[model samples]
Target: MLLRRRRFPILQHLGVFSNPRSFLLHPLHSPQYSSSKRNREQLLNSMRDLKTVDAALDFFNKMVAMNPFPSVKDFNCLCSIVVKMKHYTTAISLIKRMHSLGVKIDSWTLNIVVNCLCRLKRTVFGLSILGLMFKIGLEPTVVTINTIVNGLCVEGNVEQALGLAERIENMGYESDSYTHGAIINGLCKVGDTSVAIGYLRKVEKRGCKLNVVAYSAIMDGLCKDGLVPEALGLWSEMTGKGIQPTLVTYNCLIKGLCDFGRWQDAAILLGMMMKKGIMPDVQTFSAIVDNFCKEGMITRAESVIGFMVRMGVEPNDFTYNAMINAHCLQNQMKEAMDVLDMMVRKGCLPCTVTYTSLIHGWCKIKNMNKAMSLLCEMINKGLSPNICTWNALIGGLCKVWKPLAAKELIFTMQKHGQLPNLRTYAIILDGLFKCNFYSEAISLFRALEQMNLDRHILIYSIVLDGMCSFGKLNDARELFSCLPAKGLKINVYTYTIMIKGLCKEGLLDDAEDLLMNMEENGCPPNACTYNVLVQGLLRIYDILRSAKYLQLMKGKGFSADATTTELLISSFSGIKGENAFQEFLQKLVGV
Candidate 1:
C-alpha cells in the first residue's frame, strides 16, 4: 500500500480529504478533521443566530485551522461577517492573513475595511490602508474616498479632509451630494461660514440636490454668527428652491430671530412653519416660548405652551426651564413653582437647569432658606449640582449676610470636586469683606495668591477697600505696591480706593502723591478721588490746602456736594470764631 501510494501522489492528497467522511462511516483516518468540520459547521450555525460580536469571534477561532487555504469568497464572507459584528481587530487580522495567502482583496473588501476603521474611530488607520491600496494598485471607488472624507470631518481635521475631497476630484472620482454636505457641515462647525456658503453655492451650481440637513447647517452657522436676517433670507430661498424645510431648519431660524430679539419676526416665522403643515416639533415651540419669556411677554409665553399642548407636542424640561427663568426674572416665584409642579406631573424629570432656575428665583426674593431646601431636594433626587448652582447659593447667602454659611458651602463644593471659578471666589471675597471678616478675607486672599491665579484689579480693590475701612492704611498701601509686581495695572477704582485709604488716615501728603501717581499712570482721577483729597485736608484745619484742592476739583469738572462744603465749614470754624468761617464759606461757595 505504501508503494502504491508513493506511485500516485494525487491519491495521497485525496486520501487526506477522503478520511474525514470515511471516519464517520468506518473509523479509519484521523478524527481532527471530523471534529474541526463539526466545530466549523456549528460555528456557521451559531453565526446565523449571532446577537453580538464576541460570540461570533469566539466561533471564528474554532474553525480557523480547519480551512488550510480559504477561498476568496470564503474570506470575503468572513470579512463581511466580522465587519458587521464590528470585530475590527479580528477583521483586520483576517484581511492581512487573506492577503498573505494570495486571496485577492477586491474593491468591496477594501471599502469594508475603510468603513470599519471609520466606525471604530480609527480613521488614521483607515487612511494608511487607503495608501496601501494605492501602493498595491487597487482602484479606489468614490464611496471609499467619501468614507475617508467623512471620517476626517468627524475627527475635526476638516481642512485635510477637504484637500482629500479635492484630490478625489483631481483623480476623476465623481462628487456626490453626501460628500458636499459633509464638507459644508464640517466647515460650518469650524465657524468658516463664508467658505461653507461658497461650497453650498458650488454644490447648487453642480445641480446636486440640497437636503434639509445641509440647509439647516448653513442656517445654524448664520444664526450663530448673528446674521439673523441673512439666515431668514436663506430660509426663504430654501423654501423657494422646492426643498421643504424640516423641523430642525425652522427651529434654527426661529432661534436665530429670537436671539436677536426679533420676537415679532420669530412669531411670524413660527406661524408660517405651522401653516406649511410641517408639524412643529417641541424645539420649535420651545424657541418661541423662550423668545417670549426673554421679552417679558409672559402671557404670550403661556399661550405658546398651551398651543404646544394643543398641537400634541409635550413640553419638555427645556420649555419649563425657560418659563421658570422668565418668572424668576420677574420675581414671580409662585408662578415658577407652579410650572415646576406641572413639569413633574407631566412625567418630565427635572434636570439641574430646572432646579437652578428655581433656586435662582428664590435667591432673587432673598429667600436663601427656600433656595437651600431646593438644593437639598436636588441632591435627594440624585442630580449633581453644577458650578452655577453653587454660585447662586453662595451669592444668595452672601446677600443675606450669611458669609460663614457661604464659606461652608464652598468647602462642601470642594469636597464634591467642584472648584470655585473666579466669579465665585470674587463673590465670596467681597462678601467676607462686607461682613468685616478681614482676617478670614486676608487668608482667602493669601490662599488665592498661592494658587497663582492671575491677580485681577477687582480683587486688589476689594482688599484695599477692606483694609482702608478697618483703618489699616499702611497695609492697604503695601497691597497697592505689590499689585504692579503681580502685573495688575491699577484702574480708576484702584486709585480711588487708595486715595480714600490715605485720606482716612490723615496722610494728606501721601494721598496727594497717590493722586499724582494715578495721573502719571494714566488712570485719570474721577470725582470720588478728588472728593476724598478735599475732605481729608479740610478735616485737620488745613484751610488753604483744602481750598486749593476744591479749586482743583472744580477745574476738573467735579462739583462739590454738601459733604465737601460741610467739611470746609468745619475746618474754617476751628480757625477762631465765625468770621473766618463765614469768609471761607463765601469764598468756597463763591458768594
Candidate 2:
C-alpha cells in the first residue's frame, strides 16, 4: 500500500491526473487541467467575493465537503471574510469546523477567532482562545495582544487590560502603538485620563509615534470629565506637534465646548472642521442642537436642523428629540407635536426622551389632559414610560390639583416594574402639601422613612413646609431643628422656608432670629427670602419694619414684589396729601 501511494500521488488518487503546468497556467481548461485543487481555489475565490451572509454560508458549506480539505490559510481566509460580513457567530463555528477537520490553527487563525469572540462581546471566551494558543505553543503576535487588550477594555476590565499590557511589554514582546493605544483607551473610558496621559507619554518614550486615535482618546476623556479647557489645550498641543485633528478630535472638542456653554467657541471649531474638509456627523449636529434646545434657543435649533438637511445629513431620532425638547422648553407644545409628527413621517420613531419632553411641557402648563393623552399614545405604541416620564406625569397631575390621581399613577408605575425614586417621592410630597392633602403626604413620608430611603434636604424642607402650612408649627419647628443633626446642611432655601413659616405664624421675632442665624452661618438669604419677609411684614401692617426690609431689598438690587408694591401704594394713597407718608414715598424712591 505504501509503494502504491508513492507511485500515485494523493491528487491522482482523487482523479486529478493532469499536467501540473496546465493546472497552474490554464487551470479552468477542463480537458487538460481540471483538479480538486482548482475547484477549491474557485470556491475560495467565490467565498471571498461573497457580498451577503447567505452566499458566504453557501460557499462555506461547499468548501467543507472536499475530500482532501483546503489548506489552513484558505480556511482562515474564508473565516475572515465571514467575520468581516459581521457573521461573527458563523465565523466561530467555521473555526470549530477547521479544528474538527484536524486542520492546524495557527496564531493568525486563532487571532481571527479572538476578534470574532470579542466582537460578540464574549471576551471571556476570547481569553480562553488565547489560552488555547498558549497550550498549542503558538506564539502570539502584537495583533493577538492588542486584540486581547481591546476585548478586556470592551468588557470594562481596564485594570486587567493594563496589567496584561504591562506583562506583555515586560516579556520583551515589545508593545506597539496599538497595544499602548488599547491601554490608554481603557484608562480614558474609566475616567482615568490623568493616568491615561501618563501612559501616552510612556508610549512616546517607547520609541513608538503616537497616532490620532491615541490623542483623541485622551482628549475625549478630558472633555467628558468637564475639563474642556484642558482638552482644548491638549488639542493645541497636538496640533502644535503637527498632529492634525481628525473628525473625532473636532467632535470631542465641539461637545466639550457645548457642555461648558461655550457656543461661540464651538461654532468656530465647527467652521474650522468644515474648512478642513471634515464633515460633521449626526453626533456633531445632535450635540449642537441639544445644547441650543437646553438654552431655549429653539429658532437656532431649527436653523441647525435646516443646515443639517442642506448638508445632506439626515436628522436622526436624537436630532428630532432635541428639536422637540427645545419647543417643549418654551411651552410650545403644538410646535413640539408638529416636530414629532415630522419625525414620525420621516420614519423616525419618537424615543422615551421625545415623549418625556412633550409630557413635561404639557405638565409645565398644567395641561394634564394632553399629558395623559400623550402618555396613552406612548403606551399604545409599546414604549414603556421610564422613571423620568412618570415623574413628569405625576408632577403634572399634582400641578393640576390631582394628587390622588398622581398617587394612583405612582402605584400603577410600581406595579408595572418602575420603582419611584427619591425625586418622584419629592414631587408627590410637594404636590400633596400644596394641594392640602397633608395626611396623605405624611403617610407617604412615614412609609418611605420605614423603608430607609434617603431623605434629602429637599424632601425634609418639603415636609417641614407642609407641616407649617397646616398649622402644625411645632412639628415643623421640630423637623427644622433636627436638620443639622440629620447631617443635612441648612441651605439658603431651607433657611428661607423656615423663616417664611415662622412669619406666617406671626412669630416675627423667631423669624428675624432665624434670618440672622442663616446670615451668621454664611447661608445668606436671596431675593426671594427678602421678598417673603417684606411681604410678611407688610401683611402684619408693621410699616416701619416692612420699610426696613424693603430698603434692604432695594439695596441688594431686589424690587418689591407686586403684593408689596400694591400694599405700599394703597397705604400711601390713603395718607393725607403732603404728610409723613409722602416723605416716606420720597425716601423709598431715593432708595
Candidate 3:
C-alpha cells in the first residue's frame, strides 16, 4: 500500500514527473479538477515518487492550495515519509493541517501522531492522542499500547506502564511480545530483576512463547545483579524452550562470568558461541581482554588482542586501555608507554582512560614528573584531565611524602574546571593523614562536610583512621558518635579503626567493650577486627585474653595474619610464659 510504483511512463503522459519539482511548485488550475478522477490519481502517484523533503513540501503546499483537497491516504503517505526522515515535528504539523482541511482522521493517522509524541518524550500528549482516537470510535491496537508502554519505560515510570498493561488485559486486550518486552526492560532498568523474572514466568505460563529479546532482558538484569548462576539457569531454560541464545545473551553470560572471575567458564562460553557459528564481536573480545587484565593475566589479554586482529575485528580504545592498565597495575611504566605508542602508531587516538592509566602507573612508582608529562601531553592533545587523573597525581605525590604539593594540585585541578570529587577528596585527605599533617586533614575534612556530596562511610572511616593514627582518640570518638546523626552507618572498617585506636592508647577495657557490642550496633567485626584485637591484647601482656581471641578467630575460620603471628612470636619468644604461648601457637597453627 506504500508507494511501490516504479514505472513513470504515465508521469510523462500527465507531464508531472519530467519536471516534478516545477509541477509541485505550480498548481493545476483546471476548473473541473474536483471531478477529474484520473488527475487526482496521477497527483497521488507523483507524491509517492518524491524522494526529497524539498520536493515533498512543494507538492504538499501545492496540494493545500487546490480547490478540492487531496485524499487523506495521499497525505498520510507523505506524512509517513516525513516521519521516516525523522522530521517527527513536521509530521505532527502536517496532521494538524489535515484536520484544518476537514479531512476525516483515521486510527492510522492518529497512531502516527501518538508515536511521534512518544518519541519526543511527551507521553502525556501521546495519551491525549489515544483519547482522541477513542473519542472518534477507534479502538487502540497493540502497536498503540506498546508505544505508550515504551514511552513510560523510557521516562522511568515502569510502575505506571505495568498498571496500564494490566488494565489493557482486563479489558480483554491480549498484550503482545513487544508490550511484555517493554515492561520487562523497565523492571530491569529499575533494578527489580526478581520482579522481572516473575512477569516473564507469568507470560510463559499463559502460553505466550517469549522470544530471545524477552529472555535477553531478564538475563542482562540477572547478570548485573551478580546472580550469574541464576542467569545460567535462564539460559538453560531458554534453550529447552527451543529459543536459541543470541549474541547479546551469550555476551551477558560471558560478562557475568568474567565479573565473578570465572575465567574457565567464560572461555568455555566463548568456545560454545564459536561452535554455534556466532562470531565474536569487538565487545566480546574487549570484555575478555579487560577481565584478563584485571586478573593480572597480561599474557592472556595480549593473546586475545592478537586473536581479535586475526579475526578481522580491529582493536579499539577499550582494548588498548585494558592492556595499558594491566601493565600500569604492576608499575611497569615502560611497558605501558610502549602500549600507548603502539596505539598511536596504529591510528587509534588515545582517550582519557588511556593516559589516565599511565599517569596512575607513574604515580604508583612515585614518578610525578612522568605523570605530569602525560597530563600535559593529554591536554596538548585537547583532552581534559578527568578526576581520576588528578586523583592519581595527588595520591602519587602523597605516596612520595609530598602531601603539601598534593594539596596544591587539588586547588590547581579546581582552577582547571575539574571539581574535586569524593575520590579526589579521599585521596588528598589520605595523603595529609599519612604525611602527619593531622590539623590540615581535619580542616579539609570539615570543609568536605559543608559540600553537597554524600559523605559516604568510607570518607568517615578515612578521617577516623587518620585521627586514630595521630593518637587523637577523643577527636576520633566524637567523629564516630556523630556518624548516626549524619545518617551514616558505621561499617566494620570504622569499628576496627576505633577499636585499634582505643587499644593503641592502652584503653583495653574500652576496646573490648566496643568489640563485644559491635554486632548489637549492626557493625559486626571481621577477621581483621579479631586479628587487631588479638594483637592489641598481646601488646598489653594480657596472655589469657589474647589466647581467647586467637581461639575465637580460629573458630571463625580466620587464621592469625602474618603480622599478628610475627607480633605474638617475637613478643613472647624466650619469655617467662613461653610454654603457654607456645601451646596457643600450636592451636593457631594446627601444629
Candidate 4:
C-alpha cells in the first residue's frame, strides 16, 4: 500500500483514478474531456443553487455515489457550503462519511472539519484534528491556524491564542494579518485596550502589517472606555498612515464624542466624513440625535433629523424615539404627540421606548389618563412593557397621589412576571408620605424589612424623610442611628433630613452638631443642607445662632433659600426702624 501510494502521490491525494490534470488541460485534446467538464460544471451549478440543508445533503449523497467519485475539491466545496449554512455537526458527519469511504483526506478537507469543530466552540477537538494532520503527514496551512486563533478569541481565550501563535511561529509558520487582527480584536473586546495597543506596537516592530479592522477594534474599545482623546489620537495616526477610516471607524469616534457631550466636535467630525466622501449612515446620525435630545438641544436634534432626511438616510426607530423623548422630557406632550404622529405617517413604527417616554412625560405632568392611553396603545400594538415601562407607570400613579392605584399596578406587574424593584418601593413610600399616609408607609416599611430582599439606601432615605416630615423625631433619630449598624452609608440627604427634623423640634444645638458631624463624617453639606439647617434654626426664633451660621454659610458660598429669606424678612419686620438691622437682614437675604 505504501509503495503504491508513493508511486501515485497525486492519485492517493485525489482518492480516485481520474487525473485532476485532465480538467486543467485543453478540452479539445480528448473527446471525453468536454463531457467530464459539463458534468463538473453542472454539479457546481447544483451546489450553488442549494438553499436548504436537505438539498445540500441530497447533493452530497449524489456526489459521493458517482461511479468514479468526484474529486476531493468537489467534496470540499459541498462541505464548505454546509458549514456556511451553520450545520456544523452535519458538516462533520459528511466529512466522517468521506473518511469511512476510504477517500484520502487532503489538508483543505481536514481544515473544513477543524473549521466546523471550532465553529461548534469545541476548539479542543479542533486541536486533536490538528494533531491528526501531523500524524497523517499533512502540513496545516496559515488559514487553518488563523481559524483556530479566531475560535480561541471568540471563546475569550486570548492568552492561549497568543501562546498558540508563538508555537506556530516556532514551527516555521509565521502569523499573518488575520491572526494578528484576531488577537488584537480579542484583547480589545476583553477590555484590555492598553494591552491591545501594546500588541499593535509589537506588530509594528515585527513589520507585521496591522490593517484598519485591527485599528478600528482598538479605537472602539478606547472610545467605550471614555478614552476619547486617545482614540482620536489613534484615529489621526491611522489617517496619517494613509489608512482611510471606514464608516465603522468614524461611527465609533462620533458616538464617543457625543457620549462625552462634545457635540460641536462630533458635528465637525461628521462634516469631515462628508467632505472625505464617507457618508454618515443612519447609526451615525442616530447617535447625534439621541445625545442632542438628551442634552435638551431640541433645535439641533431637529436640524440633524432634517439633514438625515435630506441626505436620503431614513430615520430609524431610535431617531424617532430621541425626538419623542426630548419633547417628553420637557413636558411638551402635544409636541411629542405630533412627533409620534409624524413617525407613524412616515411608516416608522413607535417602539416600547416611545410609549414609555410619553408615559413618563404625562406622568410627570400628572396627566395619568394620557399616560394610561399610551400604555393601552402600546399593548394593543403587541409591544410588551419592559420593567422600565412598569416602573414609569407605577411612579406616575404614585406621583398623582394614588398609592392604592400604584399597588394595583404592582399586582398587574406581577401578573406580567415583573417584580417591584427598590426604586418602585421608594416611589410608593415617598408618595404615601406626600399624601399624609404615614401609618401605611410605616406598615409597608416594616413588612419590607422582614423580607430577604437587599434593601437600598434610597428607600431608607424616603422613610427617614417621611419620619421627619410627619413629626416622628425620636423614632426617626433611633432609626437614623441604627442605619450605620445596618450597613447603610448615611449620605448628605439623610444627614440634611435629620438636621431639619432636629431643628423642627427646637433641638437647634443637636442640628448644629449634625451639621458639624456631617462635615467630619466626610458627607459634606450641600447648599440644601445648609439651607435646611438655617431654616430650622430660624423657625425657632434663634436669630443669634442663625445669624452666626449664615456667616459660615456665606463663607462657604451657600446662599439662603427663599424659605430662609422669608423667615429672615418676617423675623426682622418689627425692627425695621433700625437701619443697621435692616441692611444686615437684606445682606443675609441676598446671601
Global lDDT of each model? 0.78, 0.81, 0.83, 0.83
Which of candidates 1 and 4 reaches a greater lDDT? 4
RMSD of each: 10.9, 7.8, 7.5, 7.1
TM-score of each: 0.66, 0.88, 0.79, 0.83
For model 4, what is the alpha-carbon lDDT of residue 389? 89
Ranking by TM-score: 2, 4, 3, 1
Top lDDT model: 4
1-591 per-residue lDDT for model 4 (tens digits): 332133322222323212133322222222222237678678767888898978887786666656566777888988899889988777776765665565666899879977977888877667776776776688999989999998888889999999999999998998988999999999998999999999999998998888899999999999999999999999999989989899999999999999999989999999999899999999999999999999999999999999989999999989999999999999999999999999999899988889999999999999999889988988899898888888888888888789878877888888877788887787788888888888998988898898944367788888888998888998999888998888889899889888888887889889989889988999989999988888887777777787888888888888888898888888787566777866776776662
Clashing residue pairs in candidate 4 are none
Identify the runs in model 3 with alpha carbons over 4 angstroms from their true place. 1-87, 90-106, 137-140, 170-172, 338-359, 369-390, 400-422, 447-457, 477-489, 507-514, 517-524, 536-548, 568-587
Q: Where's the lowest-lDDT run of ten residues in candidate 1?
A: 10-19
lDDT of 2 by residue, 432-473 (tens): 999999899999889887887645898888998898889899
> Candidate 2 at residue 438, lDDT?
89
Kindly list the per-residue Cα lDDT of model 3 for residues 429-487, writing each as its tens digit: 88889998988988888888887454698888999899999888998999899989988
Error of 4 at 154 (Å): 3.9
**Per-residue alpha-carbon lDDT of model 1 for 1-591, expressed as tens digits?**
222122222212222222122212232232223346566556555556756756554444444444454345555666678777766655665555444334556777777778877877777777876776676677888788889888888877889888888887887888787888888888988899889999899888888897878888999999999998888888889889888888888889888988889878877877887798877888888988998998899999999899889989999988998999999989999999999899999998999998998898898789998999998999899898999999999989988988878988988988778898888888888889998888999999999888875378887888889899988888987888998888888898889888888888888898899899888888888888888788887777777777787777777787777787777556655665768656765765653
Q: Whole-model lDDT, candidate 4?
A: 0.83
Question: What TM-score does prediction 2 earn?
Answer: 0.88
